[model samples]
Target: MTTALLPWSKFLICALLIGLAGPVLTRSGDAIARLTGLSRSWIGLVLLATATSLPELFTGISAVAAAGAPNIAVGDALGSCVFNLLLLVLLDALSRDEPVYRRVDQGHILTAAFGIILIGFVGAFLLIGRGALDIRLGHVSIYTPFLILLYFVAMRAAFFYERRAGTIAFTGEKGTETGLAGAVGRYLAAASIVVGAGVWLPFAGLEIAEVMGWRASFVGTLFIAAATSLPELVVIVAALRLGAVDMAVANLLGSNLFDVLVIAIDDIAYTDGSLLASASPAHAGSAFAAVIMSGIVIVALLYRPGARFLGIIGWISLSLLVVYLLSSYAIYLLGH
Candidate 1:
């Protein structure tokens, strides 16, 4: 029995460690933003987003490099894309005063746009087939370079736009430089714990897939995706509790941005065939689902709908939740 439960036990412990470190990361990130005179949105976008996304990054590398599971690598990245957007629904419900879309800066639409473009590119390629292009620099897909370039372009655009918008104006009293350094140290320490947990996650996931007779694609898309995304879940909730709405929103959106970039990196690490090409084509469902979800977010950010559906979630959140569930179901059916 103990041997049978080992994978489940490892998964639970990794998840526990990730959840435990989330709040500390949040607090330290908020402090770094305050002390460094950076906007909460920027900090959340680059710093917090990257920190929280480390799990997906490492997991993808491990999945492809060690486990030789390209589907798990790709599924984890794309599934995390969908999973991260679904987080907005949770943020929406928790805000209480108004819809989360209404609380965040419209500038986020830029981040959301970039996420859509990147995700759409992957989905389209998956459907049309990457081999059709016959464009490969060695083993990696031609799409890899484009994805990497676009990610940096997106980051540059966001940084400049945020600066021009004065999002980094630093309105509050700044902390001492020493305080900032301390916060950075603490954040790194907490992140190290998350990293350790993330590294073990894929192995546990692989074992679970084997033991349960589940598809690798399904396991990656749902089970492993959820486990890897635990930090984003906790960070967003902690950010909300701290009243950093923009930070919370940015973290989710920025994580999406980072998630897509992981695909390109995974392509490079795969070293066999193209990463996306090796993945189950069913992942397109999740990719397009995430794209639609992002479009909903853009509309909500623009429309700022105030009315809640059944006085619980806004119409947008309802739409998001529905899409997430349907996509997961489709992946499950396809996996079976």
Candidate 2:
């Protein structure tokens, strides 16, 4: 019966499934973090980031395999970073605390800064490797093992600093007291649904973009980016529900860091040389947007004032994101 549905109907169903899967996976991840004695920030960076980002990975691989459009895949990953940071501002606004930023461990701030630097490095490499020198290298030789090594080093440094500072904490409610074993089972069930959804949503998204006369980069930067960030949204809401504002702030910031590092993984997967070579100029705009959003996040975290102030920042960031989106659309129109 499910197999008999039309393509668009199937796509909508899949997108809904992915949305449903996100909360379950997030809750289960919270449980596992408790069970295994891991920090929420670590879980946010490693598990939640990875699980939430599965959709991007799936869509990117599918895009490359089916259309050979490596730019779409790369754009989707970076664009997800922008979306995740924007989620931070949303979380801050929802929190009941004074300054949501003050609650966050300083290590997160450091990690985020490093992430920004790393992304800048990647962007610089791609931008520089654009022309004649790139051709001489046969293909853009930006994807080197050294890039991956540097990423690891940065990550290890962040982890070590967080641990040494004794600021890492888990803010979720106790799973054991809440019949979490049963919740885990449900989480598993939901996760299966989410995986299936992730697998199918990209196809639907691609089809929708085609019907709307949009470019692949546009589909990836906006639609697919928002879809894959659903888990962060869930995590933020859950944190607010439990008054775990720190977790909410940390999850958003850490997720951005994770997204930036995902570029390293994508680089490894992309055997076709530098990702920039195949991308349109639209990606540069997306990268700039990401940088702007990242800066806003850093400012909010560093200043750490009151709840009203954080909420104000949230509003400002949201406005900026809207502007970025409109600008991107304008650029797309101009190119067409």
Candidate 3:
């Protein structure tokens, strides 16, 4: 029993560490953006998104290596994508002024759409390769390399497009100074925290699941995904406090994109044909629901007719998610 409970203890410790690192990482990311003269959009998309997502990357890679189950990795990535979108819904509910959906420009909407389409493209490819949702071993042979190239190309395109279109202005915040030494120190500190949390969380999650007699998929989909997503939660709250609605929206959307791209990366790392072979069907359903929820979020943002209406959509999404979880749990109990 003690052995079974060890993972949960580790998970709690990791969660506390991640929670502590959140603000520091945010401060460091903001400092780095100022030091590099990068716009918030770029900073959110590249730096903040990547930093916050390191946990997912680490957990996904570790799951792949340890279980030889590419499905868990895929589900985790997709599940994170869904969870990130849900963060936006939470932000929408929490915002007091103009709904964040209305305050942000169309750039975020485009990015979210692009992310959804990208996921669909990848999902379709996987589906076609194996004639099902199963991850194909050789699917990475073509899919993974192409996705890596595509991600870089898309990023470059976004940068130039934003620059040329004047969609995002490259202005620094007030009283923000660019100091090399400070920037280096903050970067290293943030990197260490993120890496440490990433490395420790999965093992903690595994231990917890064993102790509770729960499946790894449940822990991966719910506990670990929620724990690792702390950075997004931190960024949204900070952005809201600063009244940087656009930045907040951009961060959530960009994080989802990053999570999906990580799927392609995991696929490449996997030696098997199908990434989903080892995942519980319930986990796959959760991932599918996440993709659907993301699509709904995009639609909600695009149709932003009023703040109240937007809030209603968010509530709907939240309700649906709760129902999905309850139904999924019920099914799991029945089967077990």
Which stretch of 10 consecutive residues in model 2 shows the poorest summed lDDT?
A: 135-144
Candidate 2 versus truth, CA RMSD in Å, comes to 4.4
Model 3's number of clashes is: 12
In Å, residue 254's CA in model 2 sits off its true spot by 2.9
Q: Output the lDDT of residue 223, model 2.
A: 74
Q: Model 1, 149: alpha-carbon shift in Å?
A: 0.3
lDDT of all predictions? 0.89, 0.64, 0.66
Error of 3 at 297 (Å): 2.3
lDDT for predicted candidate 2 compared with the true structure: 0.64
Highest-scoring model, TM-score: 1
lDDT of model 3, residue 70:
55
Cα deviation of 87, candidate 2, in Å: 1.1
> 2 or 3: which has the higher lDDT?
3
What's the true lDDT of residue 85 in model 2?
A: 71
Q: Pick the candidate with the highest lDDT.
A: 1
Clashes of 1: 0
What's the candidate order when arranged by decreasing lDDT?
1, 3, 2
